[model samples]
Target: MSAAAFIRITRPHNAVVAGLTALIGYLIATGTLTPPSLLLAVIVALITAGGNVINDVCDVDIDRINRPDRPIPAGEISLGGARAYAAALFIAGIAIAALTPPLCLAIAVINSSILVAYAVRLKRIPVLGNGAVAYLTASVFLFGGAFAGIEGLVRNLSLAAITFLATIARELLKDAEDVDGDAAGGARTLPMIVGVQRTGIFAFACACGAVVVSLLPSGDWWGLLYLAGIAVVDLVILFGAFRGLRCTTPGCVRESGATSILRMGMFAALAVFAIAAVI
Candidate 1:
């Protein structure tokens, strides 16, 4: 297998972004950066990479239809190789976490377990699967904040909540996009159960919740810069969510671009949070 295939299988870009989120979390918690913050970023990145790899392994069949170009489906990597890579990454992440604090170690262990579970079984469920991914995304903040103790964790809670809602909305929309592949794989995703139209509405509702929660940290504490940036972020998210309303059928939703728009909003929000933390 090519080295690029291994990297692609891990979805390294997504892992790096998740790493940045953990760094932002630490920055927000302590208002300063430390070696530990960098360590947490690496740990999160490694674990996220591992999770992505394992997910690819578990999703080989689905990927054949939904993502034919993926490493596994494209024959760039074998299932055995992907599984070993995942285990290595997870072990490395947990080992690094052990160097921090007990809290960090605990979160590392728990998140790793959840990631495996999500790939192996949870992803076949409906809303539960969406919720699992949402929680894992939000937990990066918690993992970063663990460096500063309970106070740090508490400070990051609002951010975690906003992220959780937005992630769930995106996950639901993604389910709609993958309905055919998921159905063929015998998976019971939300859109498969309630229809794409209803799933779109649920996604919209979750997006609204995310927008509301995102505003909670504005004003003097986060500064007007954050307020202004978050306003734009919320608008983009809401607009993306509004577009979901037009997706009446599975075929329509698959090509709607609503999910991609929502993902842009998320990346925008991440940038805003990082900039605010630094300034």
Candidate 2:
């Protein structure tokens, strides 16, 4: 396969999201050089990459309408080829996870199940589909801790829950941005059902709530600093939402800059948490 075909099949930009998930796991594990930690990160990355491929395969038609320049839609790659690529990535991920630890393997299975569900059925449903994606995204960190044999399941659980809610909010805002494409494809997203304005409001509330929760845990000044920074990012996101509401343009909503800021904030927060954990 050519380099162009590879890029088309892998969707490198989405791969960064997957890598971030694995990075969260690695940071929590805090064992950067350890074999188990490295293996765990690899597993998570492969699984996430596979999931992305599957998502594109599942959304080929929608993408054709929404993103005609995409590989499958643009005829740079065939649907069959995409499915094969996804299968390869999924198998590789599972193999890596199984080699890591029991907990990591179990989480990998669960993650894969959820991704399949999303591609097959859940993605068609409003709100529920987005929730599954968000929840899975948060699971990467918990999976990391598990790999480290940290008996912090409860904390990880709490983090996962909060992350899930936060991700849902982001997903909703994203839906608002893609309203036209989703609507054209008959996708029943939150924004499609509730209207973009209402969805934006809901997302802002979720973002605020996440910021508050991040700051709730005491013991660590670094974590607090991270949370404070995140709060500022949340404020910017809120501003974007309000602007989108006023503009009512897909471009405005989609390009709101909230997603990037939130991602950066989450990474910073995780880094601070890792530092606090060490100290």
Candidate 3:
């Protein structure tokens, strides 16, 4: 396989971002940066890369219609090759976690299983899929906390909750965006089952919940800098929510635009978290 195809299968950019999330969690728990935290970040990245590749392998057929440019769909990478690559990464990630705390090893194994399940089946079942994604996102924080043994419980939980809620919102919006494609693939997403308008409302509610929870972290573990940064993030998130709310009917929502805005907001929120954690 070409190097580009291999890289494409891993979705390295997304994996790196997820790894950074683990680093954030580790820093919060330890209240300091260290080599062990870096190791945890690397482990998470490997696992995320495996997950993304497995997901692509599972969806190769669907992607032929919805996303033909992806490596597998484009025939740049074979499904068998992708599966083998993912297995190697998962084994590496779990082995590394096993070298750390026992809890970390358990989390790695569980998360790995969940990722496989999500790619194989859970992701076709609407809310179950969204919850799976959100839970995995939240687990990044919990996995970090496992290393240090509950020292940063409150902050980590708050971070996890915020990530969980925001991810649900994004997942809901993404389901709406992919409704047509998912429907063609026989997937039963919320938007496909309940129509886009109601799905939009549900997504808005989740986003609003995340915004509210984001505020709770302030004046406690975070200071004015965090509040200031979070306020901007909140505004961006609210923009997405407001746009989502305006979708009063099934066809009014441009799910792509809505999904994009929410993605930006979530990344911005993460940035705010990093700023708060240090400054």
Tell me each candidate's RMSD, in Å, in order: 2.6, 3.3, 2.5
Ranking by TM-score: 3, 1, 2
Kindly report which residue stretches of model 3 are placed more than 4 angstroms away from their true locations once superposed. 66-69, 73-77, 217-220, 223-225, 248-251
lDDT of each: 0.86, 0.70, 0.82
Candidate 2 all-Cα RMSD: 3.3
Query: Among these predicted structures, which one has the highest TM-score?
Result: 3
lDDT of 1 by residue, 117-222 (tens): 9999998778988999999988998888788888888777767887898889988988888888777777788888889889999999999999888888532248
lDDT tens readout by residue for model 2, 149-240: 65534345545655766777778877888889777767788877778778877877776676666656643233655565545645654554
Give the higher-TM-score candidate: 1 or 2.
Answer: 1
From the highest lDDT down, the ranking of the candidates is 1, 3, 2
TM-score for each prediction? Answer: 0.88, 0.81, 0.88
lDDT accuracy of residue 279 in candidate 1: 72
What tens digits encode model 3's per-residue C-alpha lDDT throughout 17-78?
88888888777666578876787888999999999999999988878987999998888888
Worst 10 residues of 2 by lDDT: 27-36
Clashing pairs in 3: none
Worst 10 residues of 3 by lDDT: 247-256
> Runs in model 1 with CA error above 4 Å?
1-5, 62-78, 217-220, 223-225
